[model samples]
Target: MQAWQGIDEFVSVVEQGSFTKAGQQLQVSTAHVSRSINALEKRLAVKLLHRSTRQVSTTATGQIYYQQCRQLLDGLLDANRTVNQLNTTPSGLIKITAPIYYGERIIAPLFNRLLQQYPDIELDLQLSNHNVELISEGFDLAIRLGSLADSSLMARRIGSRHFDVVASKSYFARCGQPHTIDELNQHNCLRGISDHWHFDVDGRRKDLRIHGSWRCNSGLAVARAAMDGIGIAQLPHYYTDNAVEDGRLMRVLEQHRPHSEGIWAVYPQNRHLSTKLRVVIDFLAAELGEQR
Candidate 1:
């Protein structure tokens, strides 16, 4: 407590750049601020500030001390906030957005569980494939998958998604299994939202352009086409995992399967995350990670 004597006054003076302004901010007189800092300098045996009638500035030693003191003060403030928040029950509506299929298959159910657990907390979840403007649209958060485009939004990885190139057993039996990446050109490759399929080739990622008579933007439709032996399809593990296990579909080019991509919870960088939002994000991260 003794060592903490003049820290507040010194930090405030450095930040405000004037003893008078620092006194105003701390609700003390300018003479009091000046006396406290002088006593601190004598105790430390160091010159902390260069002062004049018109201006005040930190000494080299004072700059270093200010940085460290600022961090300590910030930590103290955060700790106080945490204690206060713990006593406050979270009760508010949180607006969120997520991809359509993932929202239906994954996020929605978890949110249902969350609602059941925290009766006071409400949710408005919007399911869409389009990347909506979170700030402009007034959304609290967004769940994004795969490689994220560069943006200012803050992101936390909740889980991962793996892609599988798969087709029905009957289709493999008729067309024969393709052993290598180049052989994909000869086989009828089903197209989805993207014309290119990702793979890890010789320890590096390679996007192979694929063509086939069958093309659909919907992953479900493309999966159905593959099951019907229309063509081979590339889809996320969630879409094809059950079918592959049940012998409805068989994975191909297993060795070349691309590395998993992160599933992220994205939110505006400047948004103040409330207790409800933090609880929801933590729940989603835990559940989604376990499912993966």
Candidate 2:
């Protein structure tokens, strides 16, 4: 094989830590990966990798080589992508994560349409409420809600996540409505996983601790409980919009409703942005930004 060919295999082995995994990444056999790396080392007359049974680490020389080669390889990928983007349609596998409710309600449908448009494209969708580390976990993108704190990751606001405090008409008729944030002290506020309710009070954000006879983790479940006149619940607009419009629920304390939270598409900053990542992020911004 050409000397230049093993650069990718060697880098993959270094990144993946095992010849087997490197081969899997490069779509080759472990024996082939081992032989190519050995050949590359033989040609260079240098020991690049310190290999052992459990894992592999780079030699001192190898570490420096890796840093330089990684940049070159990443640049080559970008150059290839630039050329291929003009010559071919966008197509690749994208691994993504999003909150379960929003993923099911919004993101899933948009991706369904995107898939129909580009049948060659593939997606591995992971939906959960927890924060995911994109780089360590090998995810291509993440759809995050609320404020962003991880400066190491890059983000783009795709849309807004508006929230409201709402209750069933019967519940309010029996208990009474709260006109201000302080009035919630006497009301049954069905809490989600978070005990603190957020609001914009006098141009500043406030976190008011709320309680009820009932509490759950799901916003959707809390919204349902409030619909049964159990108590008032704070929920994202996506959950309460249809109910409020149809009179199943009535919004209260609109003046105290916090500014709509940001819906963001986030990815690791250090990694090269591939064409697949570009298409997904651009698609999200265009498709969801219209909702703002």
Candidate 3:
């Protein structure tokens, strides 16, 4: 604890550029801050900062020490924020981003429900298909599906995404059914995978390069194309849940149905997460789990 106090004083002096300013900010006398830093230097046996008339400068060793000390202090401050947030009501605008199709069909409803339950919470939702940086773009959270490319963010799995290749009943009636992965090459495919399809066989994953004239970036568009007898499309279970149940679309190569990945609520890596974000994440996990 005494070491921490010493570190605090040292960091304050460096940031404020003067012992007097640092002492004022810490609500202590200049002499006390100087004494704390001196004690720290004696304990560490290293000169941390070079003092001058106008400002204090850090040596290479000081830079390293400052970084470590800043990390510790920031961690402590973050913990305090978390504790305070737990006791405080969540009433701030939380910015969230999600893919377009999922945002409209899945995320939007859940977000609306959250908003209803916590009227104090304000939501700024961005619906797009492009991947964006969570920290640099300043999003509080993001709902992502499939594989996570960036390992830096923290991800909490909310649900599983099951995928199947399907075509409209009319399309199947014309081109026939595909019983094997190889048979898919004989028919017109919707080609949503950027000219490829993934499959699972005997507990192993496989990627099969596919070809088609109709290419689409939108899942809904691909589904719509398949429904119009344009081609077969590989789509997530949620996208074709109602249609598949209603016999609007027919599933093909059931054994080749791709392995289900997870749905995740992701956020930037933080030493401590806010209460509002944690509650919402837990709520989403619980709600989506129940839905499954």
Candidate 4:
């Protein structure tokens, strides 16, 4: 009897909570998956699972058994993945998560280049501003801006960002440009809640709040406001670099620029780093470094 095969089937069924999903994932028929689990129970001489029409739950004995078996199975799978990665090259789906605008503007192009280098890798990008748990979400890695609050994660600093005080040429022509940071109080500003511009002149990092007619949560919207000559917006270099280079917006307070905030690639603290994740992180750090 293939004990490991039966164990694998049992673990899959319990994890998927349904015979059908487990079968599909394992590429076996539902009847076959059921049979495998039944066979496992008979061999173990104990009931391993409680099954209902909607879902499958592990019994106390099953739960303990599952935990022990899961570790063994995962170790075996990790060894296989490691060996395969060493024998071959990096391939398969690599799921990455990053901020929406940052990913589209910065990371996407890098990924395009990476794909050219490794044609075998299938890149899956999920863009969102909300923080996602890398392990729980099944993401290979996550890109984060500023300092991370979670100590459980292992973070590698990739790059840094400087704030740009910007306004459209049209707006500047009407409201006049602020020669000093203090003058920004009198001008219209487009504010994004998530983006709080802070500055450290001689080692004091403090918030530089500016009043605005329009307040938004989206960074792109704030950029659009500045593009349309709505108001002066203090945005990150990532958002304003293209606009500044294109002459659509003018940067102010060049001398009083804030200290650069850090960019990080974060992952769960693990004893072993997967090859796919390690390669991707190194690739992105190089890519973002080029932008600096």
Candidate achieving the largest TM-score: 1
True-vs-predicted CA distance for residue 214, candidate 4, Å: 0.9
Q: How far in Å is the alpha carbon of 270 misplaced in model 4?
A: 1.7
**Candidate 4: global Cα-lDDT?**
0.86
Candidate 2 lDDT: 0.89
Candidate RMSDs in order = 2.5, 9.1, 4.0, 10.0
The candidate 4 region of ten consecutive residues with least summed lDDT is: 194-203
Q: What is the C-alpha lDDT of each candidate?
A: 0.92, 0.89, 0.87, 0.86
Q: Give the alpha carbon lDDT tens digit for every residue of 1-292 in model 1.
A: 9899999999999999999999999999999999999999999999999999899999999999899999999888888887777788888999999999889988899999989999999899999999999999999999999989999999999999999999999999999999898899989999988889999998899999998998888898888999999889889998898899999999989999999999999998953467887888899899989975
lDDT of 3 by residue, 90-158 (tens): 788899999998889988899889888888888899998877888899999999988988688889999
TM-scores for all predictions: 0.88, 0.70, 0.75, 0.68
Q: To one decimal, what is the Cα RMSD in angstroms of model 1 from the true structure? A: 2.5
Compose the digit string of candidate 4's lDDT tens values, residues 1-292.
4777698889998899999999999999999999989989998899999999877999999999999999998898888877776666777898889999998988888899988988888999999999987888898788899878957888998888888889999999999999877788899978898435665566676676778779888888899899999998988888888899999999987877878888999888885776667778889888777766
Q: Which regions of candidate 4 deviate over 4 angstroms?
A: 1-88, 194-196
State the local distance difference test value for candidate 3.
0.87
Clashing pairs in 1: none
lDDT by residue for model 2 (1-292), tens: 4758679989999999999999999999999999989988998899999999988999999999899889988888888867776566768788999999999999999999988887878999999999988889999789999988857888989889878999999999999999988889898999888888999999998999997899988988998999999999899998889899999999988888898889999988844466667778888899888884
Enumerate clash totals for all models, in the order shown: 0, 0, 0, 0
Give the residue spans of candidate 1 off by over 4 A.
15-21, 28-31, 50-64, 270-272
**Models sorted by lDDT, best on top:** 1, 2, 3, 4
